[model samples]
Target: MSDAPIRVLVCDDQALVRTGYVTIFSAQPDMEVVGEAGNGHEAVSAAQRLHPDVVVMDIRMPLLDGIEATRKLAGPEVVEPPKVLVVTTFNVDAYVYDAFRAGASGFLLKDSPPAELVAGIRTVARGEALLAPTVTRHLIGRFAERLRPADTARPGRADLVRALTARELEVLELIAEGLSNAEIAAALFISPETVKTYVSRILTKLGLRDRVQAVVLAYRVGLVTAAD
Candidate 1:
């Protein structure tokens, strides 16, 4: 990791929400809140100017909305993109799908513990995705349900599946089923620390940044079918 502190930009229409995030992040020695915005358009502009490492974006912001802001900042068009961690109030919000599709690196509920928020920002800043499997499955299920049948044919899926080892493949399936690390360890008869190691190795071997990317890869490769 780089020696620089992880710079963050908090984007939320609610002033209190922004202030709360600022307070929480400012207390971290390794994190710095570089800027703030109250809407999506401002968020895009701030990202371009400030070049923060991570953006804590609210999904329902006015002007452009967090999904569009995320796309503009981290979309495929950009040569170098800042990581976006979407903030939502609901666990199963439909906008979460749009946020992921728009290149968001992670999702955090508004009521998430302060530590989880800090960890999420750091994880995304470190080039990792921070999707919980349950949240991921919910997002994918919603996406697949709305997808047209003609778009189901994803290319390069076979190669991705062939890339996984037997153990890694097992872990991937369990992940799709929405098992937490502790639960996954118990299910696999392994230690939680071992599970974390396997998860990290899986991310590296698969060339996936985080669990969110892993879920997307799993869906794209048909390793975990939408129906499953």
Candidate 2:
């Protein structure tokens, strides 16, 4: 990581909640709270003006919603976008799934421990996607039904087979299974560095931004399913 402290912007609809996030983020040595927004419109404006490295975004807000704000900040059309870490109150929120589709880099419940929140910011700042294990398992699966329709037209298993090597397909399947680099490495009897290389290759070949997209694609194409 860079020696510079990670710059952050916190956005929420409530004053007390925003302040709490500000206080928690400000206390971290490696983090700097650059700005705060009480709603999504302000979040987009603040993110554009301040250019925070990571945006701690809330889901529901007045004027605009966090999903749209995240899209404005980190959507695929953006030339260069900050990492967006979406924090919400509900674990089963469909908005969280939409946030990911809008290009959020991470997702966390508002009730997540301070340490997890801090770690989430750090992870996204490093250009890594952060989804808690439970979120990966339950949240994604819970919304699988809703996602299937939009995903039905996406590239299917045959496309994936043609586009990737057998080993790369294995790596993608393990990724969709929510395994970390170390876990995948152990499972395949390969080094973590090798797994990292495979992941990078998979992302490049598939034109995916991160593991979240990879997981989504895996499910969409029937390479893996929530049931599995």
Candidate 3:
């Protein structure tokens, strides 16, 4: 929101890819390319050193993978972690959920348009989790079968249900369903600001880093399902 350009660190194994990202990001007047990382190890080290507002990370890399690097930079134990925006190819869509679990704030397909990638970085920089509809659908389709079992009484369900009010639960369900704050407000007949308040409360109560974790928890607790 401030005039300060959003600081970004691009991390990938391929030189060409990193160069491409730098070019695109540098074109944005509101964004700054603070640094670059060739692998996950360098990503973590560089991120620690640069403290960029957002990290553009590739899921596959040498030494440490992007997932582990994301964890090191933004995991729950981290203090004041920078937001991570993971970029993946179709072959690695299966790792999408794992990246979110590892503390990624958002993800984009490797072939995503330059505009989309730029917007993703901005979204995460603003402390928003960017789970596009296609990405969410892919996540459910890829892992839903394994996530579901006949028994729905998973551990931590009771605590989660008890921790949130009915409205907060509804908001969480909408979040898991991939609705934006405006969409959730429309669906619930509440103002967008009100929806945001509910979201903040939900995150605080759940101790989640962001809405990505909220969605994962919703699936893990049987609150929202692939069928839904």
Ten-residue segment with the worst summed lDDT in candidate 1?
Answer: 145-154
CA deviation > 4 Å runs, candidate 1: 90-92, 142-154, 174-210, 225-228
Off by over 4 Å in 2: 141-161
77-167: candidate 3 lDDT, tens digit per residue: 7879899999988446558767766778998899999999999998888666787766675685456445432222355655966789999
lDDT tens digits by residue: candidate 1, 35-118: 999999999999999999899999988989898999899764566889999988866666777777677888889999999999
Across 1-228, the per-residue lDDT of candidate 2 in tens digits comes to 279999999999999998998899899999999999998899999999999999999988999999999999988778788999999987656777888878898988899999999999988886566886556766666665465323233555347546899999999888878787888999999998899899999878876777777777777667877677
What's the lDDT for residue 102 in model 1?
76
Candidate 2, poorest ten consecutive residues by summed lDDT? 148-157
Model 1: clashing residue pairs? 129-210
Worst 10 residues of 3 by lDDT: 144-153
